[model samples]
Target: MEPLARRTLLRSGLLVAATAVAGPALLTGCGSGEESPARSDGKPRRGGTLRAAFTGAGAGETLNHFVGGTALDMVRARALHATLGDLDPSAPDGVRYGVLETIEVNGELSAYTLRLRRGLTFSDGSALTARDVLWSLRSPAEDPASLPVYKNPAATFDFAGARVENDHTLVLPTLAPVADGRLLLCQGNYLVVKENSDFSPEVATSGPFRLEEFVPGEGCALVRNEEFTHPELSDAPYLDGLELRSLPDSEARAAALTGGQVDFAHDLSPVTARTLGEDERFTLTSTSPPYVSGLFFRMNLAHEPFRDNRVRTAFKLAADREAMVESVFFGDATVGNDLLSPGFPDYADEIEQRPFDPDRARRLLREAGAEGMRVTLTTGPETPGMVEVATLYVENLVAVGVDATLEELPAGQLFADYPAYTRLPLAASFSVPTPALPLYQMSYGGQNPAALGWDRPDVDELVATARGTSGEESARAGLAAQRALWEEGNTIAPVFKPFTTAHVPGISGVAEDLFEQFPGFSRATLS
Candidate 1:
């Protein structure tokens, strides 16, 4: 299929095969139990600097990533510090342990134990122990220096009751029964640091790479910890050095890759992914499902017409999910089922798919006395897919006799003011990949502002039940809550698109790391 014309996005309405051009079908699961395709030239090459281009690597960049607001910030954090772990459903305990070996939770889910791997050391030659972990987790909340990502560790876990039994062991006590404590603790925010030590770039960190040089808004250089070795992180620090360059523009990121200035481009637009993927010189990889962002639209209950369930149902029914995935993403994404987390254990995949039925939608609107209702869909390029998806959805709404128009906002301004954002009758947004229950609790459940007044006490109880238990009991309650939300929720989530990266042929480790969104070169190589 011919590639969609550059940036025009709406030329002949031809849907191209996005993945067909996304290099070879290597089937990399991006750390959810799939191997990255090996470099064609056999054994892994030993040492060279690997350059990567990503946006938000600007002047505001900080080495302390507790409040990382950009992709590059988190990228640097993962590179410079060893993390607790990452949420990986494929793992037996739903996590991939990093510096710490295991997180054992008791039956009631209130008590927990953290066991660190023995013999871990920092770049400054300090022995990494449980005391370091205790300080790092508590000090953030005490001084209140951390950001939104740091909230869970501070708020959920009871640090006051946490005690260190020995150098390698820390026992934690939680305020309540929590089944997914491991996920919360190991979600990359928790790190180890010396007691009472400020997180200075000078201190020995948890990662295998040491910072060599840093210049805000431009880039930074990192040197490998020559003695660093990780049992699970594949051949880490294999490269002698790494360079990160900041290029905020998608076009510029792609240009850098094609121009030989950068060996890898992070988070390209689907259009660029398809274009570069078609080139034989580069290999395209995406983070796996349940890890990708799920695009959604929330119809505020406080808004006119939406107060009527039929109108909300009609608006959802009007969307043509398949066409949006094809035309907007060029078939790079999967169609959402008016719900998020398509493949998660808690996701209600067995539920019937929502269908596109303009006829039914029109009848429902007429029944609700909402025929010819005028609603402005507030959209922006929050992600490459948001505006395009809104455009197509509005067209579908118009087909059902609703006067729907797209109101595009400048990038970064969409959620800059939360009040104005949530006040819109129709808001278009997308959520980064997160576990099912916590994601809803954080964004869509209860009276959360992002929920847009979706208040359902029963659903909340179901979720609470699900979150407090495990195995079959949790699944049953979680599915019950999700099924209710799927049938009547105010949000219209229609597709989940992966975070994509494209690299030159010699790039071998981009898709193997557990943190697939911002890949690390600890295992990457140059030709």
Candidate 2:
């Protein structure tokens, strides 16, 4: 797969020109009947830059459809392309159909038809057609190495049979049926691009904003798409432009937030969230992250030490999850008890949090006849809350008479380049776009970059059956089977489900939607 570098930027004034239909809606103190006179009109106002501060080590080369890295990509892409469906990141089952008119799952979901609205154009004034979809899908198939997930069985997108049925419709022929085809379409994997567009050092995309200027390690600026049209967004974008600045350090990003140097900020911790909440100029909202962060182990069944499941169980018990969540995450994240997140409505409810007990961990190790086992725990710079968590893991494991060392490397080194069995792709750990297929592919699907060289025929069968079955009940059963398989295998240690919190002041339309960070921006207004 291509190596996309991490870009870093300063969190500064990111908002731009706006056209307000009315004045800002003033807010008062909690439960105060007296409203702030500054904000009265609730009408959708247009115009004002929406500057966002993000934290990351650095920036990568391509912002193209294929290069999925960093929060920068998400921020930039949301302004650039509109997906088939809109996932409101704030609430449950809030995903709304957007670009694609309707998704039909008849014929066991083996067949799907996507109908586009009458007029759809890219930022470059190029018309969006079914052909663009075909070209984009085929681009990944033609070069699976460039698109890592294509190698996984769960990444069962049908590029070969993707056809432009007509100007309005595109037909997809999957190898097997999929339960939630909409999940695949709406996720990050299906970003639409113009056919024949060059994706060399830079990427060109079709969205509401065009990438005007991008300084690799600093930030990016986006301008409005003159040819784009979407009635769903009332005052859409509300601004003439948007700027995303990368603030590499959390402290710096937090400082910028309180200084009012930036209009909005993401990835703040619970403490930061609290501090920002106290500010009169800002409001903070938290959402369950689509991504799941955890400790993944490469079990070398054929190699030394780990051939025994007892060793794995011991290692899992040694790590104190509650301590990590409390100290590192500041109680902002949910204890990761299961591989699947609650965001997936069909996800099983039984994957409860595995408690930490050193004695049990040690006993399990002794029972496995494991002694002096030295293993390397690899992590990356972007792994927030990882430093302390890793340290605690190392200490706890040592206390259990197990030898362990924490190996910290850049995210690109671990994930984008290395194969799944030996090292995990740390920076790209999130199974987002939708947690469903991404997790399915990462665990059981052979093509996943994160599969860790482990597979079960039964699990694969379950996933395949689920994909091929259009019935909701059958698909749910398959999902349950898949989740069960993950727990049984113990290949990856799911630590906690992180939360996405943002602090914004005097801004409306920032709903707690699970799919997208900023929803109804078209209907948003700023003072």
Candidate 3:
């Protein structure tokens, strides 16, 4: 089975995998039963310097992960930009206020009344009000980069709009009773930025940290927000200042951590993590994030080999999932059958995974009359993990008699042609949130790789239906249908959920959630 000819595969299609993995209702039951801050034995102590390193040396734009979409940048964003509430990775749907004080969920769950914390203020002393929430939600929704990602959700106030009942209370109206709306609010996209605020280095916020400095694609420094309040975050963030430096490379970040140039590092590979974890001078905190890592099969029905379903199935069967996970992921990942991660509430447990059987793969290819095919895999230079994953894929495809080549480009260049890029029977890299909402929006939503033309009425209907309903049963049914659509179409191949391994030293509080979306920095205390 030769890989789909580069020209044949490049011929095109587009499909996006935009759904989030698990809803709060489903996750609450599966998460680790960790007690909240009030119950924790550790006490927060203010003030010290906390410098952290990213696998990449730094970030590209404002400390806005939503626009930039880098996990490293997100850590800083979480601290400077608080979400409407905090998504407790430990609790399935538990969303508590990071800046706001409390939220009253009505009996029907269709409406909510959010109360601002009494003395909450932006870093500049501007009082936080409903106006900020409204602006933050609306501004990004209107941003060009965000439209492709943030879709209309009945549960989130994203489209429905919020009404200010008073200075302290906000009337949040929703299309449906979103049991997990609070969790969605904690995502990188939905963060509550200040009203009329542009995320810039000079700006400041109400979170425990305030951005003191930022050098795009380089590093950032955050100092404590003296006005921060919250008993849960008491004495918190022992660090007087936190320096977020992005190294731009895993090797450099690891070296910095080991050499003591940096106190902490994020997104370290399994090998680097293991090495650092063994060192007594440092402590490792790792979480099985709700992110999915996988091979994206370009869905251009217009393309040659891809147009033949048999060819797609053959490649899917030929690739070795377990080997890739074990070899590339360092045995620290779970096999993905499709876009949905097990952590998501909408995940289909019944979906069968095609094992790594080259013979069967060959048979499928032969049956499809695919005598010889070739394809080019497109990925980014900064995607360290993808490079390794692509290498394994190439090796496996070659073993199964498929001819494949790897094309690595800069991160910016890859994303520019993301849609048409995948059409090349190419394997690309992506990590999305656990929710069906975010996942669906990025994959199959309007911006997906179905670059040529994609109009899956059935898929759209399922997603639309899910988006419309608020109840668990309806959501389950819609998600089931959506999952079926993904499986039936072979839009993208599931790979593994990578664990975020962090190395910390002289830090008393460094807890991580499975979502790996936000770092609980408010409670972090430097020893």
Against the true structure, what is each candidate's TM-score?
Answer: 0.80, 0.82, 0.79
lDDT of 3 by residue, 151-185 (tens): 33322563446787776777777655555556556
Better-scoring candidate (TM-score), 2 or 3 = 2
Candidate that would win on lDDT: 1
Q: Candidates ranked by lDDT, best first?
A: 1, 3, 2
Candidate 1: the clashing residue pairs are: 58-217, 59-217, 81-207, 82-206, 82-207, 336-494
- The candidate 3 region of ten consecutive residues with least summed lDDT is 12-21
Candidate number that wins on TM-score, 1 or 2: 2
Candidate 2 per-residue C-alpha lDDT over 371-409 given as tens digits, one digit per residue, 9 for 90 to 100: 677776676535355555667767777889977777766
- Candidate 3 yields a Cα-based lDDT of 0.58
Candidates' C-alpha lDDT: 0.73, 0.56, 0.58
| Cα distance off (Å), candidate 1, residue 211 | 3.2
User: Considering TM-score, which of the candidate structures 1 and 3 is the better prediction for this target?
Assistant: 1
User: Residue 295 CA error for candidate 2 (Å)?
Assistant: 7.0
